[model samples]
Target: MVSIGALARLAGTTTRTIRHYHAVGLLPEPSRLSNGYRDYDAHDAAQLLRVRRLVELGLSLPGVTAALGSHPTPGAGVRDALLALDADLAQQAETIGARRRQLADLLAREDLTTSEQVADLLRDLTTAAPGTGPDQLRRERDLLELLETSGGAEGFTGIADRYRAVLADPAAVDRIGAWAARFEALAGVAAADPVVTEVATELRMLGPELFPGPTGSPAEDGGHGETAWAAFLASLTPAQRRCVELAGQGWPTCAP
Candidate 1:
């Protein structure tokens, strides 16, 4: 027989934990000594050790109770409880494995947020126009992300499908590439230069062929369409701005 502190040391647990186990009826309380202090025997220490082992095996206190409460024999109850726990662990492992696979796929693609359809559209655009640079591709992706954020996923899909159709024509693709090159070349030219006017005229001619008519509906925020168009124009060079303005005047339907 030993004091509570001695039993705790022998069982590799704390006196508070032993007291808690006794309060929770997990461990049987030992008899009190002449000094009115609890004296724990070897049986009590063994019981505490078994309770700790059960807890380390992932059994809850209640589960430990059910497993050790078997009067005639504890073997069958412990075996059943362990089998149930093993099944739960297996299910948790499968869930973690599936999540890991998803993370791997996202890492492999490097497009954690973009939808597959949007990714395919970007790839198609790059293939259709060889000179399409990284900046332009990033802008296109940002626009797609904005569309998705603004609750325009369905509408954006329709737009993407239409754009894909427009890019399918080889002539159209070459014409678009040539027009982009011409526009970029005019970046340093005067806004009123003859080349600006010429580019503007060419844009007017190409607009209808390249783009379908607008949806005529307001943007997701009811007026963000106009705001976004204004922002886009603000970002362009003066010559490009002049060309876009002239083209819009010549072909009102071509204005974005």
Candidate 2:
């Protein structure tokens, strides 16, 4: 038999922890001798060692207790539990590795610019549309950085080319310029005017057919294409606007 302090030291645990385990009904309370001191026997030591081993293997107290009561083969349940934990940990590690690889590919040089360009364009669209706020802008920027760094540029470029073609179409250019003017007028009144909303809605509707994928189309992948186009249209200069208008008429407005 050993004193609690001696048992704690031998078991590499604190006396307070042993007391706590007793309080929680995890460990059996020891008998008090005539000398007014508690005495722990070999059985106590073995139980303490088992508890410690279970803890080290990541078993909760409840789980350890259940394993201790039900397991016919000594340490079998604990071993199975540890194996399950190991398998879960391995699966998580593989998922993390896959994400890391994807990030590495996105950040490669050729992919970066196209990703940013697409995101920046989307942000402009959302800003121009109603009920959008700074939170939306921040999210767009975060997504842009992720996609650009994530090697999504090939898909991005294909969408961008389609937008450029749309802008080059003489009829589309005239419509867009007229739409911009109407929007400018509406903005001069109330930024949230019904006309502004109408223009935004029209743009949203046409955007799907024009861009056609996650970077542009609502059908292919929600409103990513529409948002990107809105951003690009928002950033256009007066000269670029004119060029887009002229493109509709089958004429180059000016040199690129």
Candidate 3:
């Protein structure tokens, strides 16, 4: 028989830790001696050592108690806990490794501006529409950026083939470019001008091929109130608004 202090020393832990183990019901306290000093045995020393080892292995005190108190099999609980800990550690290690690799790649590059997905989209667009103006390219990139938020990069991947086909056609690209320029020209003109009607006709014809199908009714847009659609029209100049309104009249219930 030894004193609690002696047992703690043998177990390589503090006397406070040994008392904490006893208080938590992890280890049974030995009886007091004639001198009113707590007497501990070799078993107490061994159990205290075990608890310290478990704590060092990352088990909480409560976890250590649960793993040690249960004796269904020979140290089965401890083995199970260790295995779970190992698995968690492995997953963390893998995540860290992946981040390290990404960091390495970033360091290796000098002129990396956007994400890989955005960069790929820019490359594909350039191939599809050679000699596209900077302003037009920037506008296209902005549209794609919106798609990136509304739909994921995968959504762009799905539509890339179709967009590439349209961009590859010189006539289609020319028409789109012309419409863009026309919108700029119509910014200040009167909505009821003869040219508004003519532009509306062109829009009604082009909307079918480019926009394809009814976008929404005049009263509602995308099941939401016409507020958003109204705002969109309000943003356009009077001539552009008139052209769009005329086009809508020609193809009522259709939107493009």
Candidate 4:
């Protein structure tokens, strides 16, 4: 027989844990000494060691209780509990593996947060239209994301679907690319610059063939659709936004 502190040291646990185990009926109550302190024996040490091992193996207190019955031995109950725990761990591992694979797929995308189908179409378009800068690519992605998430409502007029059909032809991709290059050239130019107004006015020639709809319907709709449209316009440069305002027939816009 030894003191509670010695039993704790031998079992790799604390006196407090041993006391808790006794209180919860996990370990048999220990003998008391003449000094009124608890006296622990080898049986108590062994039980505590088993309890610590089971807890470290992710067993709950109830599981530990079930595993170490009133008359515990090397029995089928212990094996069954371990088997159940193993099955649970295996399922958790599978779930974690699936989540990691999904994360890997998402991280692999250069155009993160853009819908997958739209990104595939954009990839083909970008390939056909070489020499487009990151800014142009990002803006186009933002537009595509907006259109896709909008659920093809009255605002976008299903222009996303129209773009899908048009972009399938390499020739259309080239034309869109060329127009984008010209527009991108005036990136930092003043909104009032003659080039800005000229490009804004000229957008009429390009809008129908490329986007083909009542273009400013989101602003006309007056709701979250309008807010989303404003955010997209706000993302553009001053001259780019000015051109959109000029082209979209009195669409209100902001730039910074």
Best by TM-score: 4
lDDT tens digits, residue span 1-256, model 2: 5999999998899999999989988899989899978899999999999899888877788877777766789878777777777898789899999978767766864435344476446544453443434544444454444334332467656545655565557676556545545544442444434554565555454444342323323565454544544454355444433333333232121112
lDDT of 4 by residue, 1-256 (tens): 5988888888888889888888988888888989898887777777888889999999888888888783356656667888999999999999999988877877889866655566776786676676778888778777666655543454343666677777778777777777777788878688889998777666755565464323444544444455556678878889988777777673222111
Off by over 4 Å in 3: 1-56, 60-62, 97-114, 124-154, 166-256
Model 2's C-alpha root-mean-square deviation from the true structure amounts to 10.6
Q: Rate the local accuracy (lDDT) of all candidates.
A: 0.74, 0.59, 0.66, 0.72
lDDT of 3 by residue, 142-184 (tens): 5455444433455445545556666678788778667766655
All candidates: TM-score: 0.50, 0.50, 0.47, 0.56
Clashing pairs in 4: none
Global local distance difference test of model 2: 0.59
How many residue pairs in model 2 have overlapping backbones?
Answer: 13
Give one clash count per candidate, in the order shown: 0, 13, 0, 0
The pairs that clash in candidate 3 are none
Cα lDDT tens digits for candidate 1, 76-189: 788888899999999999999998887777776757867666777787888888679665566567655544444356656676776788779888888877887788788789
Candidate 1 residues lying further than 4 Å off, grouped into runs, are 70-72, 113-256
Q: Which scores better on TM-score, 1 or 3?
A: 1
Candidate 4 structure lDDT: 0.72
Q: Which candidate do you rate higher for TM-score, 1 or 4?
A: 4
Rank order (by TM-score, best first): 4, 1, 2, 3
What shift in Å separates residue 230 of candidate 1 from its native position after superposition?
A: 24
Error of 3 at 84 (Å): 1.8
lDDT, residue 12, model 3 = 81
